[model samples]
Structures are given as structure tokens and as C-alpha cells.
Target: MTPLITDPLQPVFVIAGAAFCVCLMATICSPALTLFSQILASAQKKVFYDKFARQLATMATTLGVLCFTTMAAGILHTALEEPALFEGPLRLPLMAALGTLTLAFALQVIYSLTWNSLKKNKALHRLFGLFAGLSMFTAVFLSLGLKRTVLAAGLSIPSSAPALDTFLAVYSIPAQSVFWPLLAQALLAGTGAAGALGLCYLLLRREADNYGRDYYNFSTAYCARCALIPSLLQTIPAALLLWMSQPVLSPFALENPFVLLWAAGIAIPLLACAGWMIVAVSAAPLRHKPAMITAPVLLVAGYAVQMFAALRVYALI
Candidate 1:
């Protein structure tokens, strides 16, 4: 089977897409962590804000900008390359995605910029963070639906009858079958990225900021624990996605050496990172400095391998 993309720019798009995914996930998850800190560690809210949430908010803002820029560029590229793609049932969803993304970005900026001013009003500020995360998740949901619509188009599936039906279809079971698994994978991947990034940030600041070992310990443990839940649970969705893909790629997966390599590439680092995180969280004083440094590198490697493998598979199909 021929690949889906034949353009010379395919590599660029793939890289950009992967980066955009990471940025979007970070954008969504950062604020979520902020909200979690606000709610769960309310007593330590000041320390959390000073040490973690504040920086996370800034990172989320920067990532939100990158996500918006990349998404807009992608949309424009698609519109220019294949105008007909937007003329079909995907138009509504596309519009919804753009709107949601814009709203998310705006909310993120407001949430970040108002941090100092809103310090006195924690309730309102947390609401802003919560809404920002929700809007970003909605954008992701609509984008995924748009992707499914494009795939359905390729398969010659008919568009829904009602003008709004396609938009609403995402709420149905069949749509959810696709959505849920992807969502799980995303949460797993996103939180992994978040944890890795958080750890890296802490490592960089540890010496220069002189925040004290106690602060670093708490932050490191916090980030690892946040990522731990998703890392452990990711197998369920990973298995589900594999099961779903079997009908299409079963033979390819079994026969192709590269597939096996890529699968291993995805699993091993993730497991190692998860195991390291467990150790980091369980140990007194959170001692794994090397793991803190390497976690982000491992995550990027995993994402890179996953993207390459996916692109290769798409090419063959």
C-alpha cells in the first residue's frame, strides 16, 4: 500500500505535528496541575504557587502560543493544499476547533497574566485555570473528530444527514470508541511530557535559585506522582489501540522488523520512566537526580520514535 502523504514536506509536517501535540498537551495539562495543586494541596498553596504553579502557568502560556501558531499554520497549509477537505462535513468541526483553540489561548493568557493580581482571589483564579484546561480539551476533541471525518471521507463514508449531525456525532458511541482510546493515550503521553518537563525545570533551577533541598524534594515527588497514574494506566489504552489497529495492521505488525523495533521503542522508555518515577516518589528525599535529567530526554526519544513509526506505517498503507 502507498503512503498517505507523498509530499517532500512530509517530514517537516510530521515533526511539526509531533511538537504541536506535545505543546498542546503541555498547555492543557499545566493548568490542570495548577488546579490540582489549588484543590488538593490547599494548605501548601502558597508554596506550590511559588515553586511550581507559577512557572507552570508561564510554560502553559508560552506553549499555548506555540500551539495556536502551529495549528493555524497547519489549517492554512491544509486549506491551500486541499481546499476540498474543508468543503465537506469537516467545515463545522474545523470552525469549532479554531474557536475553541482561540478561547483556550485567551483563557490561558488571562490565567497566566492575572496570576499575581488574582493571588488574593484563589477561587476565581482557579476557575480561570479550570476553564482554560477544559477549553483546550474541547479543542482536542473537535480536532480528533475532524481527523476521523477525514478518514471517513477517504473510506467513502457518507456524511451525516443533518447539517449539525456531523458535529454532534462526536458525542455518539462509535465516535467515542475512537475518542476514548485516543484520549487515554493522550493523557498518558501528555502527563508524561508534563512530568518530564517539570522535573527538568526543577533541576535547572535547583542550584541557581537555591530553593532548598526540601522544596526540590516536594516538587520532584509531586511531578512524578502526577505522571505515575497515567504511566501505569496507559497500558490499558495502549492495548486497546493496538487491538483496534490489528484489523488493519496485524500482518504488518507481525512481519515488519521495524514495527517491532518501534513498538519496543515506545514501550521500553515509557516503562523505564515509570519505574524511575516510582523510585523517585517512594524514596526519602527523592534522590534520583540523573533520572530527573534524563526523563525529558527519554520522553522526546519515545515521541520521536512513535512519530517516525507512525509516518512509516502511514506511508506503507
Candidate 2:
């Protein structure tokens, strides 16, 4: 008999499979959904963000489906093989992560639907981002810790050629040796955490400064939906890198430290730069046409790359 989550590879694989479906759904429907929402609100005569309430609603529905699938698989894993999976210290954290993720996604769905209805509720919007950040942070810690514990235990060692294949079959991702550069990754996390907090400040600043006006300039629905995309985008990469590097604490993909120097040292910083560019572009007076087009294009491209990387690492591609 298989130990539900005991087959560490199995549960991760299940999660990845569900995520694959979500990616397809997001890619195929997100644009269409956004367009539909705009059409529905054509008569609203609101700002661009306000008019996107329906788009957020659509995003919430799609993401809700994704989160539900993930939770269902996790619950089933826990329920079917409770004794094996629940006997250890890791059990509680695992369950906690799953539950939080479920609640976050569920709230996301509701938040998405009612953003327009709750447009003035800045406090609530901040709470949503708070929960989202909490969820991602907890998830990163627990899931990566669990994966590290398993790897260190030598429970899933390979003894054959095609080592990458062996690793994926048992670990549910491509072979990634990551135990050496722990400090760098930790620094990355620190940077990322700061960036995350900075974004939260950006989101909340409008409300805090505005006397009685809405804190979030956008409709509640649109803001809620928009909130999710960034959270999910950041979490997935962070989780994956964290998981991959647990074994050795180094960059997972590149063998040469120099290579890592470029990937983590250079690429990540560039991505950060790009993020700030978007922020500044969004706030620019007059909103230059080049910035307008470049910002969204960059964001969409970045998200697409992140999603594709997730799929590949998880072997969903």
C-alpha cells in the first residue's frame, strides 16, 4: 500500500498536475475573461481599473477552481493514508499549509466576485493581500522544509543511469542539486520579502493618504483579482527554487558558480529592476505610450516565463 503523502513524489506530482491544468485554463481564458468583463461594464464610465471588476471576477473563478483541486488532492492524500502521513512532525505543517491555501483561494474567489460591490473597503483589500502573503510565506517554509527533510533522509535515492528521470519519478521534479548556495537563496528570499512588502505598501498607500476616498483606486473586484496574480507568480518561483536548493543550498540548475552568478546574481536583480520599472511606469504622469505598452507586455511575458518554468520543473510540460 502506498503512503499517500508518504510517496512524496506522488503528492507533489498531484499538485503539479493540477497546477498544469490551471496554467492552461489561465492562459486560454484569462485574456478572454478580461475582455468579457470590460464589455459587460462598458457603460459603467469608470476608470480603467474600476472597469476591470468583472475581469477580476473571472480570474477569481479560475483560480478558485485551481485551489479547490489542489486542496482536494491534499485532503485525499491525508485521508487515505493518514497513519503513515500523519505520524510525524511534518504532518501539522503540511495540513496547515493546505488549509491556508484553500481558504486563501476561496476568499480569492469571493473577493473576485464582489470587488466591485466592496470597492470602498480598503481595509478588506489589505487583509486580502496580508493573507495572501502569509499563505505564500508559510507555504514556502513548510513545503521546502518537508522536501529537505525527505532528501536528507535518503529515502528516495537513485541507483541508476538517467538520474534526472529517476529523480523526477520519485521527487516529482527534474533533478536539481541545491545544497551549496543556501546563503544566496536566503538573501534572495530576503530581497523577495522586501519586494513583497514594498508592493503591499504601494497597494495600500493610496488608501492611507486619501482622506476619505477609496484607498485602492481600482474597484474592489478588480483589485482582488489583480492581487492574486502577483502573489501566485511570486510564490511559485520562490517555492520551486527553495525546494530545489534544499539539498545543498546552491543554485539548482547551473553547475558552475559563475553560471549561478549570472542566473541568480544577475537575472534576479534584473527582474527586480523590471518590477520597479513597471511601478514607476504605472505612476508616471501623462503615461507615455511606450511605457504603457512596454509595461503590460513585460509583465505578461514575465508571467508566461514563470508559468512555463513551473511546468517544466514539475514535468507538466
Query: Which candidate wins on TM-score?
Result: 1
Tens-place lDDT per residue, model 2, 1-317, is 21112343544554454334334233222322333344445456545533343333444355447656765886788678776555444455456556655565555555456556666774574355345434544444445545554645446433332534433443343234442233234323333323232233334443444522232333322332332344334444445554553344334555634223323422343443444445443433122224322332333333334333433343344
- Model 2: per-residue Cα lDDT at residue 184: 30
Clash number for candidate 2: 16
Per-model TM-score on C-alpha atoms: 0.82, 0.41
Across residues 81-135, which tens digit of lDDT does each residue of candidate 1 receive?
Answer: 9997677765677788889878988988998899789889988988898898898
On lDDT, the candidate that comes out on top is 1
User: Model-by-model lDDT, in order?
Assistant: 0.68, 0.41
